[model samples]
Target: MTGTAPNRPEPPLIAEPLTLPGCLKIFPKVHRDERGRLVKTVHHETYSRYGLISSFREQFYSFSRRGVLRGLHVQLPPAEQHKLVACLQGEVLDVILDLRTDSPTYGQHELVPLDGERGAMVYMPPGIAHGFYACDDSLLLYHVTTQHAPAQDAGIHWNSVGISWPDSQPVLSERDRTFPSLAEFASPFRFHPEGSPL
Candidate 1:
């Protein structure tokens, strides 16, 4: 005796809208089974197709428990760094701020909900502030265009950006807590008179 069944289709990758001054790049990975599925997180050639050419000099991974908040930071330029960020194990509410005084999106903010289950990557240009709230105990991995420069590192207070974060009094590190508010710090990157990157 045998039972009849209907075939199920695979779900397509979800690419969320890129808020101004922020971009989301999506790559489809082939899935095969019996053993385990394979997923390619990054491919230089594929990234080139999207006009991203900068090579990474450093890579970092951070693991945070739920309700933790990190960042709202940018490195001073010529030390400014570009980033390619992804969620590997759980989920995060990723937020970015356009800090270029001359950028059309200056002072504007964007939010991206990144999930490990949905292979998504965010491209953050230099002259922007980046941060995220751990929606669950999450693992975040990222590639940077420049090496870390402790002297040139700085950040804005996360609450100043106006993004509604998870309500349970976020756990913050001392450094993040001591960071200045956006209005108190002078931007280290130069923006054109037209509000664009110089």
Candidate 2:
């Protein structure tokens, strides 16, 4: 069983499967000594053995001041994206919504606390909508298989679903506020149990 979950105590990097069918919670190797710390965020071969091997075409950062709320967003097909996300500074209450109609967890959302000190990351396949709250001044790093496509950019309103975000009045942008609610938009992605990459 190469893609084992529940965290292996001996491996330097681990991917724990979440409730969502194709999502993963990744723990990277961290070295700590008198010299402080070093976090190794990714390694293709190790991730591959865990059923996660992405081309990762682009890398970007999202910096949020304390109390900022971002996303609940996704890209449409033809420009869909596979994402690897990590909060490298501060911490965040990260959430993801599964939109694949056939998935066991469709329409359900799961959350995990991504702390800078913990060095854990999240991997989301194409149809998943993602969002997070900056518990403190946080910096999130993202790796995606596709470049940003404005025309294909899409999202569900952060408050449309039943996510228990930590902030009652977090900062928001006009664009994020305008996305359709979960009940309003029709999903264009599907789940393939035989393992379509996303």
Candidate 3:
């Protein structure tokens, strides 16, 4: 565990909605002490109030070096995921693309800067393509609503969505390089307007 678990749960932190539909940016309150700092990563009740009612079934974290870009990824249908992602060790330029066919913001993308020192996190709804650029040696913590399904794994090619990533060539896996371009993708997600359940 990075920060010691509190003896008693802390109060819920509020989140701000981003321009991208269904995406939210959260700044968790950090309590500092002589020992270090204590961060409350998730408060089920706080997230529930924000309509993120799904119970996370899995939690994972990843490490990336500067310039590494990891996605624009998604899973089809029954395997699609809703995620809460946080920076636990460094900073990243996180990006999201709306892939919902009925969304008015379909094809639009948003960029968010997350810093571990600030305890920042983002909530991504299923059907959006997500990726990040490591601004430093960074660690990301992820909480998701679904389990992994290799067969359902998919993505939009990182460079094809018009994101203005830093000019150095991004370090990418062969899989990320091979995903279809946004223009070439046939979206499978349908948009549920605000106030409707996803």
RMSD of each: 7.1, 4.8, 6.5
| C-alpha lDDT values of all predictions | 0.76, 0.88, 0.86
Candidate 1 stretches greater than 4 Å from native = 1-17, 27-37, 191-198
Candidate 2 regions exceeding 4 Å error are: 1-10, 196-198
TM-score of each: 0.82, 0.91, 0.90
Give me the runs in candidate 3 sitting further than 4 Å from their true place.
1-11, 194-198
**Candidate 3 lDDT, 98-184, residue by residue in tens:** 999888889999999988888888888888888999999999998888898999899999989789987459999999989999999
Ranking by lDDT: 2, 3, 1
Model 1 weakest lDDT span, ten residues long: 189-198
lDDT of 3 at 24: 84
Worst 10 residues of 2 by lDDT: 189-198
Q: Say which candidate scores most in TM-score.
A: 2
Q: Which candidate model has the greater TM-score, 1 or 3? A: 3
Superior by TM-score: candidate 1 or candidate 2: 2
Candidate 2, 1-198: lDDT as tens digits? 777777746767888788888788999888989997888777877877877756788999999999999988999999998899999999999999998887888889998899898889999888999999999999999999999999999999999888899877889999998999999989998987666333
